[model samples]
Target: MVSPVAVPGGAVLGSAFAWGHGVNLRRLKYFVKIVDIGSLTQAAEVLFIAQPALSQQLATLEGEVRQQLLVRTKRGVTPTEAGKVLYRHAQIILRQCEQARVDMEAAGEGLSGQVSVGLAPGTAASALSLPLLRTVRARHPGILLYLNENYGTTLSELIMNGRMDLAVLYGDKAIHGLSFLPLLKEPLFLVGPRAMPAPAQPVKLADLRDIELFLPRPYNVVRKLVDAAFVRAGMVPRVVAEIESAFTLTAAIADGLGATILPASMAREVVAACGAWQFQIVDPVIEAPLALCQSDHLPLSEPAQAVKSILLELVVDLAGTFAATPEPELAALS
Candidate 1:
């Protein structure tokens, strides 16, 4: 009997049918389920198998791969580093297999499947969620569009994990196992209560040093950009509150709690709704970058591809609407 071949990262590559004994896809599914549920007992119940049988399968998988996948504990199990690597690859593999089945079934039929798209919250992209839903519904009546509005980092991670098809988010940094298309850049603006004095000209970073500000947490993409801009100008912002919800932020601005920094489009909305004042941030204009993120290796399903095309077209049409400057040079798969 041939033995499974282990790669540098302790991932089993080939099986007996090929060059060496390999972990079968069924076992991979079991392992993935176990990891996802974080409890073999729960996984067995979900998979409709006996607990002992599930344990035996996991043991066999570990033996074949020659790497311990889960760290079993009293409460639950967690994937080790090697287990995490396997889990990530397993998600992609399972998604690809499912996509293959779906593709075959819908070969002659029109595009008809669920496609998940994420839009980063607190950015101009969030405004596209409803438009995308409407467009997909109008063009492909059979297709269902699932939209998620969340943090850029969270959205990007979902795309990387194969859980989400695509995302419009802030950031252009190249991430492993992910591809990015730089969409456009929107300038930052300072939004404050109407009760406060409004600046006639674009406000410099230094001008904001003394003003009380309400901003998202430091991990937020827009917050990071705002923080970096202030840091470069040799000052720190006077943050009165760290707010995550747009409603709460707008309410605070309306109540004259403090000012906040936001992308041009979002700032405009807040200003309009809250009867606030907005001035562009300049003297080294701070612009927030937005990009389209997707899995670098996974081929998009037919429905997903159709939705992506529509999303791209929508972005182009709404670029000016969002006060976003289109990138002259588009980077493909960056």
Candidate 2:
């Protein structure tokens, strides 16, 4: 067992020695905690250690690196470029080492585990969710998935709260204490009653000024991007209704109620409906970027990592297919 005393460099414990000594896992843990919370005192409280001790360990690490890793700000201590770099490398090394240990013990055991997954409402059923489910089912039959879907804000909160193991979202800002890896950029589309006619190709924002629209409530990531384009065109959107369900919204559009601007993922069945139609939202074209977010404290288990890898593979496949065929060609199919 590694004794507490075996941990080198107190406070910022691992920061003292230069390139040549035994690895100090405890000190590295301290440095990572400080970086995550952005303050030595907060990091101390969380780690159940004293502030002075944390400070001393950090100071010692600075000595070894021969550079300040963080700078005191009014809000908290922000990462110095050096500190940021170290934090990244430390995280990678820590995760790799942990994975190595697990692999050594397991010797490639069968995948039989449970991972609770989350999906933001917007990304829940799209490429992120669908392809991932297929791959998981085929490759890791023994793995059980506990899945839930919700709005982006709520999903991010769930990951932070440990209510979820992982979440697929389309984030505009980096959530604190979680790691987000962008997977794909899903296109934006203008959906209307199937009878509603759009041009053979993409339509301009200014031209849609008189059209009535139904969409998810304002303030959502996609809505904001849509609003910005309308603002630039000096037009106010004529809102017909606010809806959450793409299925319901599609039904409404197909019934000739009103049109909607939505992610390509949401517009799928709606596009195929006889009465409803779809077109690309262009000029300043915008796409929602799908992301995978995981808790820093709860490093991804092997099963969770398998899901992530499958998600990325699908994203890569989509990218390659899109690159070979331009949007102009695909939108014409509708």
Candidate 3:
């Protein structure tokens, strides 16, 4: 990852401006990392550097931002109000540099090469990624696919290492070394065996306490939100088992192992297979935003750009069609 701090303090490509004294792109990036992990120690570990060096960078960033960016506490450090706003802006600035790299690479390649992509669980393989994937396959056959499922943080590391060319993932949680382009926001739905009875209309959040449920392991974004909903509803989930594979989890739900909370987009295909399991939008609703991600350090190959372009076009189409589809709680997103 190109650190924002790595740029010369006074370097200006287009405009004469002072970012900060002794500050560069890398430090600002470090600041963003601290905000995301909410801990100097964890961020340092991820960066694989000494804790003292990371802390020094944070101090430099805070001074440059001219505000108290983080609030220290027993658990971890959290960004202050101003800090949160700056983090978002920093992300935008960093992404522009990445896009520039993409553009430069695109200029020479003339659109014909391969890019292996890693799909974060729900992002690349569901109805959301299906159209984009199909379009890429049809329109850019030369591009090789190294499609695989992964967690958000894990995928980001792969992207950084150049193991994967790009990815589609949930965006609330930040991952370094990747640029996230917000595509569309989608909601989650409570899915259960159709053979099992359901309330007349959509069920309230509070109604799920006693129901036997099956859900993904805790790292899943949907699972986290589902757990939070249960907490808000003044109940705990009656989770009988947890599984990571969607095929296995859906199969379990279809076989009547238990009910599970899944994104509307992913639940769509499974519903047909569940024979008896039905799904409904839960009240006190939650929505997850999915985004397209690409490696910041590596220049995309020609075929990668073609596939990415087609995928982008497909994503635009899906976002429009998704708005009209009511059956699936989630709309297609890339």
Candidate 4:
């Protein structure tokens, strides 16, 4: 029998044949797959193993952990409380195992592996997608970069599950399993069509009360900030529609449908591309917070670390340029 091997996070991996004493990687994989599919028979079909064999493996796993991990029902199987906890750890463990293999294979050679980075929509980081892709390609040809543009909450969930390596998203709120590195505080701007007369000065929160607006759903980080500001001012915004896609929002704005509030960088880009205009918000200026987020418990692989370094460098460069530009300069561009 193979000896028990200690992995990161103080977890032990031993032979699957160790039976009632130790849980092995293969069994953990089976358990995770079964939970993910929510059916043992289906999992067996997908795993190309007999149903009885998969059931036996799960029994052995439960015995090793001394916990009931699943509940069977007519609908499907669901993880028990203990199973839920184990499922989270199992995801991290599997991801670490894969990373270990990649690290070992690339040892002594230059860094090379796939790194998945998420950039939340409606934030300045979303604009970095192309730049990041180009930079990674130029710097590390061996690295495969996967960029996901999504909502902050979705990206954070992926990071917590160990499915994504890192993300640049709005919000500095403390999440349980994630760590945030605050990048910059971006002032919000009121962006609208050029057909509408541009404001000579910064617009106030109360001033936007009558203006029809196109905003993301209430759950969005930017939307929450805007809503809180409105509530503080004792005013209700006139929201014509809830739009999540930047393209769709911009299209609506270009069609003279409504205005939108966005961070400075994203606002600038939107106005420049759609022939729109933007002015900063005032009378209690609202700012959206941006941060780099990663798993608090898991370690980054070499490729991920390298990509993160490059991301930081790019953020610094972008922020410096943005900071140097004054409101007057922004107005001129608008």
Candidate 5:
């Protein structure tokens, strides 16, 4: 029987050499596959290995580090606390190794490396997705791409911790170890169901006080901006509920539960999805600044640099096509 162990604080229990020599890249990759597929059988089938052999390897991996990495239940396999930590670091290690191979193979070719990027959910769902992926595939097939869609704060934290090479997120207060490159200012819009009567003119920010609102929770950066704007306008918004998921928020608005504020791009998406109409918010013309951010503590890897350059170029080209107002300055916010 494999001995059961619990991880506390994610600290490695064994000595440095013990942890170092006991594990190999193959085992780490196998472990990650198992976690991703959520079943040893599925992972083995995908890896073209026997189930028993995969089980034995997992046992060996567990015994070497003397830590229980996965918890097997009737449903499937899930990573334990230690396994989660190992998985995150293993992803970085595997990518680095792949990058090294790509670099060697590229003797006289163009740039070859992996760039892991994090993007805010709204940004990821916008028109930028297709063009970004296509550009990378066409221009630099040697470079591997990994894209993660998350919230602004989550993306910022990932980039700062070295997990994500770059991210596009809303600029909040100054983050100490990251540099923010201003991208474009996104205007806020009020959305409601199509059946609702459209306002004759732009809805003033102060006028929002009369409308029942269903917005993201206070923890979200967008919600914070909305609340601050309301305070500045000297009116308290009638928030009916606090929702976190954008889809749920938009659906609620379409169902006539309450209206919500969203960036222009996101508002358009919801409008199309639920036959909703978006009204431009005016009076103060509130807008949020989107930025392309990266860690300032470390120099970007060659592949990361290449990806950044391509991304900047694509954003500029697309912004011009959309006639967007941009503040494209690579200024470090202190």
Candidate 6:
């Protein structure tokens, strides 16, 4: 048999399989390595096995499982739906095996492993990220923790794509092949430059008709909510700029470009970074629900499960404080 060519990541697995036969650990390891490296030839070289031999093993495994685990193309390989399912299970199995070994080696020591989590910018700003990291670092000194901050939509995509083990997302937007645990409901706030006087009272979404605003694209969860409210209020949102970066949005607002809507906690952070700003509760009392989300198909490793538990406890503690106060103290914010 000829050596299979190099395949890039995301190459589609074009075949189907009947899930009947059991897969061996050796086959699983080979399959996972190929999926991770995105190239059969590269995985074979790394495994110190002949390309043809590796290919034969993969073919045999596929035959036993009766599934096409990967789609091969000139550019690279992509996992099919079935392949993705197998890849997730395989990852958990492999990780558990490694973690078992590590635990054995560190028997008397402490838990030692790696956990990577993604967080949306708002969730990160809600006074969760730093505390989570600090607590994990302090308590599980041996556990390696990685944090990736991005938009809620992006974070969900990362979690689904297997790039992130888990993420805190907004609105519980239904994402396919994922599970969610509701965390908290955060009240929304309108943030504007410090130079702008505080609104006399809580501003209504309808009141924003004439105001210039800087917001993320419509696809963004926050923006989508804001847009829906505007539509409900029969107001035409006067968006002056479409900025995807949270940092850029804050900078623009500070420069007096326009105001934006965000969770009260996140708005406070923006005000602190961008200069003086008015943080007003929306009249209709808009609230964004956040949740801890994970892939339904991907099993959480022990370390990841530990981190998730820690995160849940921390969010409960913090959210309780926010819940006690409908509106954060505006005076103290300034």
Tens digits of per-residue lDDT for model 6 on 1-334? Answer: 2112112254433233322344566888999999989998899989999999989988887786677879999977878877877786666566667767876886878777888787777643347788998999988888889888877777777677655777877757666667877666777788888776656565777677777888778887777878877777777789888887767877888788778877766777788897856555557777777778898776776678889878876775666555523122221222
Error of 6 at 306 (Å): 3.3
lDDT of 4: 0.83
TM-score of 4: 0.86
Error of 2 at 69 (Å): 36
lDDT of each: 0.83, 0.69, 0.67, 0.83, 0.75, 0.73
TM-score of 1: 0.89
Per-residue lDDT of 35 in model 5: 92
Candidates 3 and 4 compared by TM-score, better number: 4
Instruction: List model 3 lDDT by residue over 1-334, tens digit each.
Output: 2333222234322222246446576887788888888888999999888999998888866665566778999999988876765665567566555556655766655443446666677542355456666767776554456566778778776676555667777764555556776666667767888667874577677777788888877777777888887787788889898877778877887777778777656666568676645446558877667777886555675566766666566556555543422112233332
| Candidate 1: 10-residue stretch with minimal lDDT | 13-22
Deviating ranges (above 4 Å) for candidate 2: 1-108, 128-130, 199-201, 319-334
lDDT of 1: 0.83
TM-score of 2: 0.61
Q: Show pairs that collide, candidate 5.
A: none
Worst 10-residue lDDT window, candidate 5: 1-10
Candidate 1 lDDT tens digits, 1-334? 4334344445465342232355677888999999989999999999999999999988887886667889989999999877887787777777777777877887788788778999887787888988898899899987878889888888888887788999999898898778988888999988999888876576878878889999899988888888898888889989988999989999999999889899988898898898998888888799999888998877898899999888888887767786778876432312
Clashes of each: 5, 11, 14, 0, 0, 11
Better of 2 and 6 by TM-score: 6
The best candidate by TM-score is 1
RMSD of each: 3.4, 9.5, 10.2, 5.6, 6.2, 7.0
Displacement of the residue 332 alpha carbon in candidate 1, Å:
13
Error of 1 at 189 (Å): 1.1
